[model samples]
Target: MRRMLIVDDEPLIADGLYTFFAKADIEDMEILKVYSAKQALEWLDTVKVDIVLSDICMPGMDGMQLIQEIVDRWPRCKVILLTGHNEFEYAHQAIRNPCVADYLLKTEGMEKIRETVEQTLKQIARENDFRYQAEWFQEKMPKALPQLQRQLLLDLLKRRGAKAWMNLQEEFDAIRLPFRAELAVLPMLLRIEEWGSYESQSDQRLLCYAAANIAEELLGDKAAVKVAELDSRSLVCYIQPHAGQLQQHGLEQGWERTIRFVMGTLESIQQSCRDCLRLSVSIIAANQAVQWGGLQQSVNRLGLAVFDSPGHGMEKLMRLDITGETAGLSLRQDKLAAAELLLEHMKQRLLEGSDDWMCSFRQWVEITGEGGPDDPFLRLRLLHGIADVSLRTVQEAGLSEEAGREHDLAPMLHFNIHTRWSDIIAFYRETCQWIVLRRRDSCRLDESHILMNIHHYIKQHLDGDLSLTRIAQEVSLNPSYLSRWYKKVTGRGISDYILERRVEKSKELLLGTTLRMQDISGQLGFSDQHYFFRFFKKAVGCTPQEYRDQRKGAAETKM
Candidate 1:
């Protein structure tokens, strides 16, 4: 009886397979079912299984990881993938991998699965036979070893191979054996990256098996490759080639073609993995006869080339400058830093009331709005910048009081400009903007229009000493939390904004009419002219009188 492990997240799919397998009359198979890749791996640690059937996608640590683990721990285990998404890459990749036994699309129904299973089992049996025959032939080949001694040696290698291989010459001399050549070893490295798709874990496992199959085919009879996964996103294959076979083949173009085929097959599988899963493939090409050090250098070069080359979807082979082994993580970090700087720059402009604020505001709006829900906060912070622009606009205009009419401020909002912040902010910023407008309307009409009510509470009594804490109380929120929330939504602190508006009103009173500085200060709720002068200097970097003088000089210069 053969042992099989079935991995899939969906109960219906798993149960369906259980029923189908039972009906197939393959009674000699004992099946274990697991819902996740992690569970499958845990089971693999202790349970010896002949075959594994896995789904492509699951909640966490998906099928690709499971397949890699199987190939690493049990190279002989046959993997059959049953996936729902139809993509030729899965089957093509599976055909390329030695570890994968078969690929069966779920849509093919139970009959096809049964057929694939039988074929896989048959193949496994044939390989086992080949291994035995190869061992036996090695023993009888007189040039290699005499038949009688060769048979004994073969048994010793299989039974206590680790110890025997470590001290082969010593053991041979002790046993009166005559083979005198030094031992040689060849190493192959295989690395796989995950598809950008969201295929079921079972399906992904099957795809991973397909990748392994490609590597297996490339090595053929000349090498033995062990499959393992580095993480959720990558797979590793270790290849040990037979020196004699490699000498006969030399460095062949067929091996290069095999690498291309593996990459192409992976591309095809990614297409089936769902549109989201993008893939990039990289392969290392080296002379099979090279020593372990040269091989390691070659593999490292290949790795750098694979990761460094820029290509979308599946890429075949990347040639590396074997002289250098540098990676590019530092470059990627610099790009991330640049993105943050750009975001912060936009926020600063929005808060400062620049006349070209609309352009910066809109850019921020578009970036965050497009960020989508998966990473909403990261992009949404951009929206907060837009809201900050709008709120600061109102505060700067000294219009936090309910507009006597909406049209009065409509032009300032610049809603029609293609790159206006208002349009970019759209629904997200509008939600908070409505809060400010509602406050203003509530005080103006003594009636609650949701848009103007909040502003009304603040304006009705300026002497009430309004702060985010007091303001948020009317809106039902904790002070600190509301302040942070407002800043996140508006890109400016509530306190800074209120001060800007108050200072602007004081400036308007001082310049537009003959009101004395003390009278203007008193009317705008400043304690005195001195206090107002210091406040104005801090905000504008000049005293009130100096600002007026500059404005007068600027007007005369313009005239």
Candidate 2:
């Protein structure tokens, strides 16, 4: 069955079209009715509709924008537009875009609408057949080498199984990567830094490709290297440590020697990259060698290092442990700069509400409480570092504007240190949570203010147009955006509230007025007495004269 969604802002018009299509003889068609383009887009997000017949003049997201979204999201779904004569020019511009099968002037009547729908359905049916046939042959195509290489690496990294390894070895031999099997390798992470400083590089992917080629050439003499760009700023270079360089007793005999050689090659890699690419590169050398089974751990550990120690980014060679700890807490001038740099990184992560920051927070608390330097002054310094990060996080998150909270770290500064580790950790958690609560309360207050302004404007402008466009301008918002926000705040469209108010006002005028029906209609901004009468009858179950007569009869009887 083909599904059709009809969207229009007029409740009667939208419902009328839904009822008309439900009764149409267009095969086994399923029909849905939504009052605005915003609602139609929400429906599209959850369900795929075969055809969309949308009015181009609704308040939220007009038909042209609606069709554009439909074409972008469900390119196969056909759209037929229904627009008023005044909007036909706007609709014509949209007609030039794809996925719009046709548009009809609403005055063209229901017969034309039925005909257009039938034609669009025939096209959709033929397109589906073509798609099915095309996909059947396309599935039989061969896979490419780049895809095979990535899959092989993933399987090895995951340590899939013994048979998987055998398959990988066969694939490796076929690709002629004999250097890969030559034993122990180190996972040294390379992060491209100051990339924004490069004026000539416009394409980041091409630059990364060039960097990988450069690394291969620089390390060619000392090591067999495989480099992969990990993300926008990071890369992974698996260096196969030359066998002759490792001492005979599994590297125990020359651990320092291995470190020296690796550092020299890293300096060469960094300097060569600067000379050739005009880009700075930072390398984080792991403390030990790792095989395929441990690759994931290496990635996570290194990823945390880059995040937790953003200051160490310039240090050329950083030896990172899994604890996310720096060697000293500003124990010297260099260490103090490192500490400040690390806190700057933490402050940013806290603003982003990163769960990784939370994990690092917990680990830092535990590590410092148990294994930090025994000196009292050092432990106090560590406490101050943690406090600095939290205080800055609250400031950046804008706590001062909400709940009128003071943006000061005096409480954290005056907090008394205790011997118990739990006491210290508890204090940190309590302060962070308090700021978060204050910020949320302030946001709710702001939303309430916006709602009050909307209500005030509607009541003040009953004689005016009172249309969404005018009211949205009063509040400095896009009409469609205001529509969604009003609905979200009040649980119904603004039009629904306006209609209710109009009905209530008509009841009062009918009871209290002695004026002619046309005069009363003019006061309500209705187009004419006839439109006013029809609207009253639909809402009040009686014509305006009838409603007045009934009210007079009730008053006499009560007297």
Q: Among these predicted structures, which one has the highest TM-score? A: 2
lDDT tens string, model 2, 130-208? Answer: 5666775455433454445545554444442345444544676654443455355567788887675554545666677
Candidate 1 on 280-330: residue-level lDDT in tens?
444444333233223333344444455555763344444333443343322
Model 1 misplacement above 4 A: 23-27, 88-92, 130-132, 139-559
Q: In model 2, which range of ten residues has the least summed lDDT?
A: 327-336
lDDT of 2: 0.68
Q: What is the TM-score (0 to 1) of candidate 2?
A: 0.49
At residue 469, candidate 2 shows an lDDT of 52
* Candidate 2 Cα outliers beyond 4 Å, as residue runs: 1-108, 111-186, 189-212, 216-385, 396-398, 401-408, 414-426, 462-491, 512-516, 519-525
